[model samples]
Target: MIGVYISILILLAIIVYLYFTKRLSYLLKSKRKLLFKSLNKVEKWFLAGSLIATFTFSTLTNLVSSVIYELVSPNSNKEFLKIDEKQDTSIELISESNEKLDKLLKDASIDPRDIEQYLKNLPLKDGKEETNARIDEWYQARKISLEIKELLLVVTKVIFEQNEDLTNTITFLKSTGKTDFAGVLENIQKYFQEGDAEKIKQEYFSRKEKVEKENILILKQSIKSTEALFAFQQTVDLYKELILVEPTAENYFQTAYFLHKLKYFDEAANLYQKTLKIYRDLAQENPRAYLPNVAETLNNLADLHSDKNEFPQAQEKYEEALKIRRDLAEENPIAYLPDVATTLNNLAYLQNVKNEFSQAQEKCEEALEIRKKLAKENPKTYQSDVAMTLNNLAILHSEKNEFPQAQEKYEEALKIYRNLVQENPRTFLPDLAMTLSNLAILQNAKNEFPQAQEKYEEALKIYRNLAQENPRTYQPDVAMTLNNLAVLHWSKNEFPQAQEKYEEALKIQRDLAQENSRAYEIDYARMLIMGVKLFKKDKSNLKIAKGILERYQEVYSAQELLKLIRKLE
Candidate 1:
């Protein structure tokens, strides 16, 4: 088809050249002249020969020029840089690469930090002498990296140690495998006392600099089989080569997964797109194996979009993935049904965001039904998923004013979450707290004030504990719960309790807003307004609220400030 188009284009070009160069006008000297028929045989033969010669010569010249230019062009090399899904690689080669990768990764972590800290602490700037502070940084980084690498390597070995129960996914997920390499850090610290810092830096930090250089090739666009796949730069280097050499979907998919986890969203999206394209092209020939991959990639990309608040793109990709999963699940329910439920739950939330309440309810209910069956079969695997779906369902029921239905779902979801938290608090505590908070909201709406207060206190306790450990992540949750409890108390005319809760919540909000006004200022403002309304007659609180409003007047507007102050009056 391309050849045919090129042939037609060349033919048009020749005619245009002849017309524009006046060669055609030479044949049509006068309107009345029948030039070809009126011409003598010799003249006619000469015209035909000239036309044939010109056409042949022009075609050959253009073809030769195109060949030469393409051979010399820089863009000819660009194709090699991209992962071409249709490249004709030998099946044997692909299989060999797969086997090699499988052997390497089957029992391996692929990234044991692998001198990552060493690489990071190595002096990137090399103008002046390395300061003692710089040396100290490198020493500390090495000490930390080495210990982490040792600990993770031990864990990985235990987890994937060719056990008889390797297929027991639950055991792996819930593995409380403890490392025996505990006192190694203490020993290192004891030997490398504060006075021996110079010697430690000389022996450890400087020596590892040479060793860590091998990882830099990920940037150099070279492939090495031994490189770690966790650090951003190193993984990019290794995977880019894998994509170029074998062009497998796994290569792109794994890289994208890591990048997404590391918050490299843009590059992760690009790799996911490439992975999806490859899976799609491969699926045209082998749908059974690659279609699942296509759906998975779509789901991941949709998640990335949702995280970035690109909701339209997220919804579109999720629906595409959902359709694919639903079709696959009809044929192989056990294999693909979970994916169907997962996508349904994802889309349900998106629908709720778009205010498509009916569709959201439908999706959530469908997901809940699917997950319930799956959880019955494999409680350890699918129970959390069931709980998640139920939580969403309860919210949908609440949206439609089905209080009893919403209450029932929320209770069931909280029961599952609380059980899961008992088994693995590190994993499911937050889930429990979140459901408790939602249930409390519903209770408050139903005016079950005492029940609401109980649930709020429970959630607030969890949030306070969590905030003590990770204030940056859980402080906002703490403040929000406090505000809820305060309002509950305020509505009951419990002024002392309300004042205490409101003061605590507002202080947290103020601290958080100081660090990130864009995220927390509105919450601070809302709490302030609540406080002012609750204590309208309290001269001290009103004065303080007015002062805060005046301080933040520029953040909103002077008119907005005056109106806020008017509410206090």
Candidate 2:
């Protein structure tokens, strides 16, 4: 009844507005003005009273309707504003988390006082028991919550060495779905004081203004007791920072070398390039002493750039490096053959990327021929290098979309890697898993979905097992496989399941990307863009998709595919 009344009042109000605007009033006046013009004063007065009463009634009804509107739908704009505010808050939280992670990495040696302080400031639950109970409930409600939280908790506990109940914690986690907790253990081993002592001693000895022999001897004694890898990493990082201030060719080379080991590609590339420049200047002044280092540095820089997909830049650097190596090999035929072969392989890789399959094939064959000769004469000594070269050839074949050749090469490589991994499960399983995953990628590309899934699952099992043993190294890999599986599902039009897996992958990437250098940022951004596109298909999310696409290009450009993307309607 109230709604009907309000609707009628609103309609009448609209009519009144039209009349006042002269729309309705003009129509009525045109037809009725002459009829009213001859009216007597008393009659006109009566007519004016009726008109006034009707106007008063309509005005009162409009006022009542507005009051009802306010009561029923009060402050809708404020409610919408609140929702927008929360979304902004979430974005802010994500940004803050990233910053915190960077700070943690930068001040790795600073004893995490800030993280501790933040934890203390965070509102505590009633008690640890109560919190545990709630967590258990969440675990029951969402199986993943318990697994993820426990993995994080255990990893943190191991890193901090805070709790004595680590055995129980590990046991509990081990009982859960095949989650990788090994990363925590590895971090523990890396950070434990005694484990790092040797590294510290070595760094101490390597100081340019060398420590006194007596000091070195004392440091060697101290090394027997120090175990923390994190401390060594901190020391190494400090040394790197100091080296940057007055970077010599040697210092730059050392920094680049270590950064490469740490997989910090951008930093490593910059350092390597700087080292190359310095060495080149030195070589121009005195070619004999610095040429070898200059050539090696160029090659290293080329390799780094190649890995980062700066193929054109990489090709130029590789050619320069190859010229140096080839010139040196001509002079020192016996000693430089291996280096020449390595350069050939590197060149072949670039050629493969450029789709010059025949040229790449010739280069690989040349490298393999040299390696085979070396291996035949000294099988035990050159076995591993020979195996690796074969693997490289296989990869080149894969690049050319020649599955049979690639598969054959992989099989050959697998035979070697399998044996090696079997002899050392802890060291080799991860590599085996990686190989399996690469093979899986090939399978997926061929639309052999079931086979690809099998390979991925197998790789996942290995990675998960390794992650269980050492998560820092392997959990992210498992997450990647999970994502791959999800993509497969998505390709099959299994949207809901794909979404679930994507969310899972996102959770893992969120954590891992925090620790990774900018080299991995593109991968993270791609995943984000892919997720947004998938979600937006049934909705309109042009803005979010565009933002992700923009970020992806920021980290990576020069790909031709981006032009096609721009052409998208």
Candidate 3:
């Protein structure tokens, strides 16, 4: 009996120790800055290393920075992801002069084939004359989004103009009959005119997301009547309004979401921050209610930062989002597991960027497993997700130099997308093209030049066909594929072939950049830079390459020109 009592006492003591130690470890992890280096590394320098002085300094710097970062952030170590955002300025779309708008209005309606095919698809009862007029009006509204989006900026400036001479601007707005943009402007004008701006903000802006979802849905419905022109401004103004509304996290998040879609990174970043700040507080108060939003906002903010190349911020946000989603998934796997997979896939991509291939592989595998399970449950909803994760995994494997695994993953993803395309050609066709292009890249990396060429040609063909139907959406893909093909040709020492591809790709990119610089300039510049690399060693060839970029000195902004020159050097 005494021996049994003694065993019970020891077991109780062990349990008590574990409970306290667990609590203590949590506190330490959150509060303390752990040393980054291994004792083995320190001991090697101490005992057997030759460059003690140099290695020691580097070691101390790492350690110091770790502690300093801990102090600076008061947050845990955040993983960094690559920024995917391009050089989109505050003003994304641009129109140099008011003349562009006048010319746009004067331009002929779109092709008769386009109008006829579109009308054939829709149920229309109007006579040919009325139908043609409607098409012309709709055509102009469509052109505003593509040909000269910056006209809206000018329109806004005109709307805000206090000066009495608003005749031409008014006439221009009135001319946009299909969009009813003038009437939309009048509503804004009347609202501003009627209300005290501060009072309007106090009442409207203070209203949180819960009360505004219905309004947001109504705004979406408004998208049909106003099209892209009015929808972009009105939706952005609704939940996303700045000076007129108070900072509502949902509102700001929604606003930032639209802005990000519009490639307004600078504006999006500020609004995302406002959303995050509020969401963080709300999450702290009610994790169950608001934590998902916190994770969502973090995910988007991380993506925004990633686009901007702010890797550190991206890492921190992705990790936090991953953690939150994991927790949420544990509580409700059906709802949150997909989110967990998405965050994991994101982290995997970032890890690949950081050259942590093993870590990336693990995350990709985990994401693949989760997505596969989800796809099994709801194949229609999650099949694409599975393919996406497989694609990401394939990239990770390629980065790790596991060629066979990469090839297998890529093929699996390609097969899935091919099958999907059979059911929904329009939606899945792009995915098919994307996977082909990626596989072609992998083939290039492996020096299977023939296979690479075949894949590139296939992707190029798809993109070319898609671009014919939707140039605004798919032309960039055409340029990208052409550039990649150029690189492949250059690798094969086919200088003439490479040069032809490069020039063709550059021409397409130039036209696209002119149409929408915010969307395409970085791509154009990057392709030019890549093309220049081909002639880096040959002085004569290099001069010609430099000439290609230099010819456009007048076209690019001073800042852009300088940056390109520096990059070239």
Q: Rate the local accuracy (lDDT) of all candidates.
A: 0.65, 0.60, 0.63
lDDT of 2: 0.60
For candidate 1, the TM-score is: 0.58
Candidate 2 weakest lDDT stretch, 10 residues? 220-229
RMSD after CA superposition, every candidate: 19.6, 34.4, 24.6
Ranking by lDDT: 1, 3, 2
The C-alpha local distance difference test score for the whole of candidate 1 amounts to: 0.65
Best by TM-score: 1
Order of models, best TM-score first: 1, 3, 2
Candidate 3 TM-score to native: 0.54
> What lDDT, from 0 to 1, does candidate 3 have?
0.63
Per-residue lDDT tens digits of candidate 2, residues 1-569? Answer: 45455556655764575466455654467756654565569756765665566666667777798888788976535533443343334323323343344433332222322333222322222334543454455456653233344432332433333222323433443554212432332233332322343444444445435323223222322221121122335434544644544466865775576566456898888778788888989999999788989888888888888888899988888888888888888898567778888888998878987888888888888888878777787765565667677777877788778998887777676677688776666545666777777777877888888888888888888877766644655667878988897887787788897788788877787677677634344455556556655655322233433444465564334133244344332
TM-score of each: 0.58, 0.47, 0.54
